[model samples]
Target: MSSIIHILQTQGGEIWSALGQHISISLISLFIAAIIAIPLAIVLMTHKRIAEVILQITSILQTIPSLALLGILIPMVGIGTVPAIIALVVYAVMPIFQNTYSGLTTIDPDLDEAAEAFGLSRAKKLVKFQIPLAMPMIISGIRIAMVMIIGTATLAALIGAGGLGTYILLGIETNNNALLLIGAILSAVLTLIFSALIKAISKLSLRKMGILFATLIVLFGGFAGYRSIVKPPVNVTIAGKMGSEPEILINMYKELIEEDHPNMKVSLKPNFGGTTFLYKALQSGSIDIYPEFTGTVLQALVKTNQKVSHNPEKTYQVARKLMKKDANMEYLAPMKYQNGYDLAVTQSFAKKYNLKTISDLKKVEHRLHAGFDPDFYQQNDGFPGVKKAYGLDIASAKTMEPSIRYKAIANGKVNLVDGYTTDPEVKEYNLVVLKDDKNHFPPYQGAPLMTEKFAMAHPEVKKTLDKLAGKISESDMQKMNYLVTVKHEKSSKVARDYLEDKGLLK
Candidate 1:
């Protein structure tokens, strides 16, 4: 129960912000879709063959899965709002298109004849009679499209599009039901409000021309103002990771710039995933900067087959060389801490077996229960790699979220679990971190990966990040992780506080 409240208090603002972004993306896409679809509908009414072909084409687009469409668009349009908007618009087109065509075609021919009898031209009949009569159906179609787009907008959070989807994804990732419920409710309410507005607009008589014109003007003006106010500078695009670490880094940078260098305008584009995702974002230029581990970049790009070294400087140098030669990227200065993977066991279980290291576990391997994250089970550096390096195979293994693995081990659900060396829970739970006698895992030296172009353009930014390099020891990293992941503190606030303590921010 306390945990629920903690999640809400910490994540509420993000949930609200995500909701706002989701609504913005959905409505903008719906509006654009209406503009294009309405015209296409009118054209189809007049030209039967073209309308048939177009409707079929749009239907096919509708069949494409939303996430798949977004993925396809990433290479062509890159990430963030543009690709999200495009995918939403494509998804929305068919409904509005079908309804507009139906509404126009279903209108009585006698009404057109009556208009002609009154000396109205074809254009006059379309504008004054056919369009007005078909509006209710068109509006209904729009309402449906808006709801669908709102729901799918949550997926945009995956690509750092910043919408209500952020809450849903975070909730799922952290297993927070309250956050999920709140996000879902907010999306539904927003959809209802938009649908009601559209319905009211459809019901309004054409005689209220002044009111209608004023409303349209106000909406357009509001949108223009919003675009100007929210749009970050054209010069700098800030991209980072989605979780606590990225959030902390983003907040630190924002505060430092705002307080000390207000002249520079920046935008934050956060992508949430494991190290591989952030690395790819940097490599593709979808992100300007992101926090990464030197070992990950080295292994992923340089030599997946090579053994990992504990020497942070050597790892950084190797990663730096690979980035320049292979990825056209740069490895920024390392952080003070190491976030390397650790093999953990509950204190009671560790004491009973007198287990303390990978070698100590060898005798008890067949009797011990193990837990691994799903990705860890599959990755080359995960369980299979551990087994190969240590020659210790546990009696049972279950895959779960990394955050929960510690708790499961603490509670005796599992005797052994994979954990980050610096996780605060190691201290909290009094668990034993078995020494890596064979050094299976590499030194996960925390750092930032940046494009050569960004490095050249913003040398000061590089310098600012470099100052923190090798400053965060493993214990410091673990405490910071605990503050955000376990304590439920806002990542941004925590990051800002840390930077201020270090005199990194004015």
Candidate 2:
């Protein structure tokens, strides 16, 4: 109870932002889906036979898994709101389409005869009679779509479109049940409220509904106008990938910049898609700063496998030098910790098999069910490299969301799962991190990657980041992660506590 209270108190700001995003994304997507679905359903209904074929096409879209759809969308559209909105719109089409078709076709033929007798045109008949008669069913469809969209909007955070899912993902990564509960409960509540609001709106008469629609358009237009005319509050925007250590480091930067300057208007954007997404965003100047690892930048960005240094400090120096020389970003001074990837198994699994290292897994490779983060499959030095280096052949390794991977391993869904050395769940779940005895993976020294122009523009912020250099050791990071992931504390609170303890913040 106390833990839950602390989380609410600590993460109140985040909850509010997520709620706004949740509402905006769901509403916008629903609005767009309605525009597409209504006309398509009208056309299909007129053709009769085409309705079944088109509905089936939409059914196929509805059948695609949300994660799979997002995976396809991310690569093609690039990550962020556009892909997420498009996915939601796709999800919503079936409900709206099916309902609108049902409504239009099932309408009384007598009304069409009466309209024809009055010499009314097709458009006038639809506006005056057909649509009005079908109002209840169409509204029901919209209500259902809105409800579904609200729930699905949470998944948008996975692809860097911030929504309520941000808290849930962070909660899962930290192993914090409190955080998870808060996100789940809040999402459910938001869904209910949105459903009720849509239902209430649907009950209004046609003229009233038109008024409501006009009002929404006006409000949205005004907001857009105001945003364009007025400057945004956030001056410096930095993002981080979805993980505990990344969360911690990003919060540390936020705390330092905000607390020191008191009114600097810094915006710390969390819940980036992945390393690849962040790298592209940094390169394209979509984001100004983010925490990235030496080895990840080496393998994912520069493909530095040929001359990658195995040593942590040397790797940081190498990555830093190259990033400055070759990329739009430059590496800041690194944190003290060297958080490399680990192949983890449940403690019981390790004890049962007496497995101590990656090489040991080769003996029982076929027996083990494997799971990893999807990003791992993309990196040159990730799962494939692990497979090649260890000479192990596991027929199928499922790629899952990083947050769920820990639970998946612990629950016996998978014998082996990917983990980071600094991950709190490793300790919290009693997972054994099998050693990379062959040194197949390179060193991953954690550091901030900032847009070089941004760094040059704000030397004060650079100096502030430099203060964090070599301050947090591996043990220190593990303890902080443990507090958030296992103990269910907010990362802000955890970071704040550590910084105060270290006398970095007062």
- Model 2 is weakest, by summed lDDT over 10 consecutive residues, at 300-309
Q: TM-score for model 1? A: 0.77
User: In model 1, which regions exceed 4 Å deviation?
Assistant: 1-20, 46-52, 105-136, 170-181, 206-218, 225-236, 255-262, 271-277, 283-286, 302-307, 342-379, 382-419, 423-439, 503-506
Task: List the candidates' TM-scores in order.
Answer: 0.77, 0.87
Error of 1 at 184 (Å): 2.8
1-506: candidate 1 lDDT, tens digit per residue: 56557766766776666767877788778878988998889877989889999999999999998867876777677778898999999989999999999999999989878888999988888878898989878888898898888888888887778887776655544345666676777888988898888877777776674487568658967986998899766545556654455566666666655565567776666535555555656666787877777766765556545555678788778778877887778777787677777788887888899988988988998888888866467666678878887887779999876656766887778888887776677777888899988887877777777889889988877766666766766666566767876665656778877887877776
Score candidate 1 by lDDT.
0.75
- Clashes per model (N, Cα, C within 3 A): 11, 1
Model 2 agreement with the true structure over 168-210: per-residue lDDT tens digits? 7776766667777888898888878877888898778878988
lDDT of 2 at 339: 82
- lDDT of each structure? 0.75, 0.82
Best by TM-score: 2
